[model samples]
Target: MNHAGPSPVPSIFPQFFAPGNGPTDFIVQDFAVVMIVAAMMMAITYKLKQPMVIGYILAGIVIGPFTPPFSLIKEADTLNVLAELGIIMLLFVIGTEFPMARLRTMGKISFAVAIVESTGTLLIVFFAAQALGFSFFDSLFLSLALSITSTVVTIKVLEDLGWIKSKSSTLVLGMLIVEDIFVVTALAVLQSFAAGGGEFSLPGLAVSLGVTGAFIAGVLVLGSRYIPRIIDRAGKTNDYALLLIVILGLAFGLSFLSTGIGLSSAIGAFLAGVLVAESNSAAVARILTLPLRDMFAAIFFVSIGALMNVSLVPMFIIPAAILILTSFASKLLIITGVLVRAKFDNVTALRAGFGMSTARGELSLVVVKGGQDVGAVSSTILPLLGVITVVTTFLAPYVIRFGNKITLTETKKSDGSSNMEESSSGVG
Candidate 1:
């Protein structure tokens, strides 16, 4: 055997500063700084009982090129790539946790609620954007950014309030699942439209929708039947390492294939998750993926903040304010009305409405970022949506709390009335 000269003792001090195939020292340093700042900000927000999403965004803004005290990042391209990866991971996790069976349990009522709320908000925001001198595409993209609510923020608030198991929360979550499906599907069609040159062509739009619909159907049908078996087999090996690798392979593989087919990588990653979720080993996959998901998701939010030009906030203040008000009011009222129409009580309707109204955080940012990526929307839309996301995310907990208090008081009064009636009957 040709003894490869006893592998020259590897340098104990590895080349930290030398040119290499991997990211440079500066990139690693920048990442460390980002994580440190993110941790500090998140800790502060946690202490203040606010969403850590706000902290992550603030940290990004602080370190971003757009902000004061000099930019921390050397080149944005690497960070952007990481951010894109982060988005893929975030959406993949969303797909895995998607309440497919739960949607069935809630039935069409939740779907109706989601459709009405999303449509109502979109139309209102679209017209508002048009009236404000935005381009047609800008208006359309703005409408989408405002229409979708942040499932992450909503669930966090529900958990904090110990209301996750409440009837209203259940309904709100179900409605959100439907809303997510609608938004993702819409994103695919819109991306196809953007690929076709960002113009309104009815025939092109139809073609995009048809292809997207067909693609989704085929993936779900075929993937559900086969991907689960692979997962089950992996699980059978009792090799967690192997299982994790397989899951990642599926996510990236499907994402690449989707892009190859001219669809957003997000859709593919999400679909990959959906397929994995169908498996008996979904719980295992989720457990294995959570840490990775959380890390990348944080990076995604930070990247969104970094891309935002805070100075432009003054310029888009009016539009941002208009959208915030229009979206909040439209979503709340539309959802409440629909729920009432669906036979839910007034208190329940109000609670669900308030729960779903605010916190347009992650998905909103994703949509606007996607639009910007495709040059379908103006650059200003990112900062505008950033403003909307921060404001709404900050207010989400308070809004849900107010709704809870209202329902609690109503319940107490109703209980009092019942007790009074019993006492009167006994006295009689």
Candidate 2:
């Protein structure tokens, strides 16, 4: 007591004494944890010859709130914001791959396949959802949710399977573009319906479509003219950083513009990419922005995984299982038939169908989330969708790989025709 209570104890960690707690610490910690876990899982999957997407999603599940261990993420909103950025960047990259000429070339067949497949999926899923006892609105929302395929996941799967340059791959990409357009239109109708403006508000729907069409036209006409000129001038400086900044600025600027007009930011970012791609600087810009696109894209998938609510899965197991099975089968059949009708060979049609069947990831998530936000979809649908997406995404790569193997065999058979010609010429 006389010695001042044996001296005051000094703590080893002094950073705690700095200031008031804020989001910075939480964000840093959460991000570090997510990245570390994701990296480790990715390594494990690589050793097993699996896609990195599975690892990223599993990493999210490990640290997510639904898991047994306590959640490590304290700033979910920050993660969401980053995920949104990832979406924009991903779409921007996709847009860069499609110039106006390419779009025009792919338009007819792509639109045919997309319209048939999407409409077929919607009708099938709608009736199936109703048979499963969902309400009219819920069935409508669910059908829409499952209609649009996940362009990101499908492309990743195709690339991983080494089929990215195949004829079917081209059709798949084209179909995705068509689906994106349909999704924009569907979202507008859904928003109107959710607001109690009736299921088919002629005036509202017309206005929405008109605005969207005008925006696209304007971007293609004006942006194609100006953006390339600006990028060319900027590229003359030969500064990689400056080129990247300009590209990103255009991407984000267009994304913001799209959102302001009630369209998806992804569409705008894509258009921006398309404009930039028309420029001579496209190659340089793609190379410079690749890393940023990849990094954020990983975060986006992880955030999707983090949103999974495992406990709710058991509540709708029967319906979810049915929906997944029927949705996959129907889409596969519909897409295959459409491709065949469009003059694609049997193997190519089947391959395209299989690839398209695995398209229930990001776009489905958007539809479901939009419905929930507007009170048109029930909270119960979230986990069901999460489970369906995970299952389909995990299976997609294998399915595509199998299809590729079959296509390769068909190619070899076709090559045999060349041998027949050679033999006939020698005999002659």
Candidate 3:
């Protein structure tokens, strides 16, 4: 106050702008921890002959808030963004790999199987939840949550097993695609009910469906025509960055549009991938996008694991176990029966059913969150579903691998029986 002291030195960066001491720094630290832990876990899982997906999830559990020591992630929002990015990329890659011709060939059977399996699961789960003392609205939400298949887990296991190109893979992929569409519509209905204070409006539901269908049709018709041309041009430049930008632009753009219209961004991303695949440059795009997709996909699985609240698992263990068993058995039997009725051979039908019976994953979580948003279900349901998802996802790889062997053995036995009968008839 007395003498004029030297003015305080100004930092080159402001408090909010500091590189290593700001909120952004915390996010970076969190991500670094996640990656380091993930790497270590992945190594262990690899040595154990487990899917890397499981390793990523385990890593998340170790670092997640639900774990013991301390939460490594200070900014869950940032991690959630990364996880969502991972999902978009994963679906985009899947879309690019999808062949429209194969979808066309399997369309009818896929629809039949999807409809039957989903409807059957919904009815069974709804009644079961009611019997367990859940209210009608809560049961409806729970049933919807249980009806979906985890496309991410299923496809990852299938691809890892080198069954992605198998006959069953086609049906499994097709049914997933159909379910993706159905789930979007169901979510719309759920959102409507939630917004209406638990009162579902039939007209609102119809409008949502109409809007969704129109958006899809528009994307397919318009995007299918123009997207290929844009990709073709970008491919000719041979600029990997430009091509990636273009592809991501289309993906995220459609995804944004979808969410704006009350549907899942994933659906839009998928459709975008399908549209891009129609172009001559799809192969190049897929190749260039591989590393990006791999990174994000891993992050997505890890994020899913991080959301699990292990402490709550004890409270609903019994109900969760029952839900898991019912979900798995109902999906497998109903889907297989539907496929068999649609004239698919026994082996293919069973394999497809097995693949489809994995955890409900993202859609299930979404339904529970929606229920919470509307106060339709207790918070207890969230952790219950989370535990069920983890258990089912853990078991999926083993089920698909061994289920194939069992189906193949049965098929061989049937063939041998038919051969014996034919030979005996010839002798007669």
Give the alpha carbon lDDT tens digit for every residue of 175-244 in model 3. Answer: 9987866775576566555655665567866776677678878987887778899999998998889989
lDDT to native, each model? 0.82, 0.75, 0.75
- TM-score, candidate number 1: 0.89
- Compose the digit string of candidate 2's lDDT tens values, residues 129-243: 9999998778888898788888878887777656788888888888988887687557655654565544676776777668777888899998888899999899999988899
Give the residue spans of candidate 2 off by over 4 A. Answer: 1-19, 134-141, 188-199, 369-376, 404-428
- Candidate number of the best TM-score: 1
Top-lDDT candidate index: 1
* Cα-lDDT of candidate 1: 0.82
Position 232, candidate 1: lDDT:
88
Which residue pairs in candidate 2 have backbone atoms (N, alpha carbon, C) closer than 3 angstroms, thus clashing? Answer: 150-359
**TM-score (all chains, Cα) for each model:** 0.89, 0.83, 0.81
Give me the displacement of residue 352 in model 3, in angstroms: 3.7
lDDT tens digits, residue span 1-428, model 1: 11112221124324543446255666776677677888888899989988989998988888777876566665567567767898789999999986356545666788888988898899999999999999988898889878999999999989977899988898888888988888888887777788788778889888888888888888887887888899889989999999999989999998888777777788888888888888888999999999999888888888778877887889988778888999999999998888888777777888899999989988888787777777888878888888889999999988898777653322236446521111112101
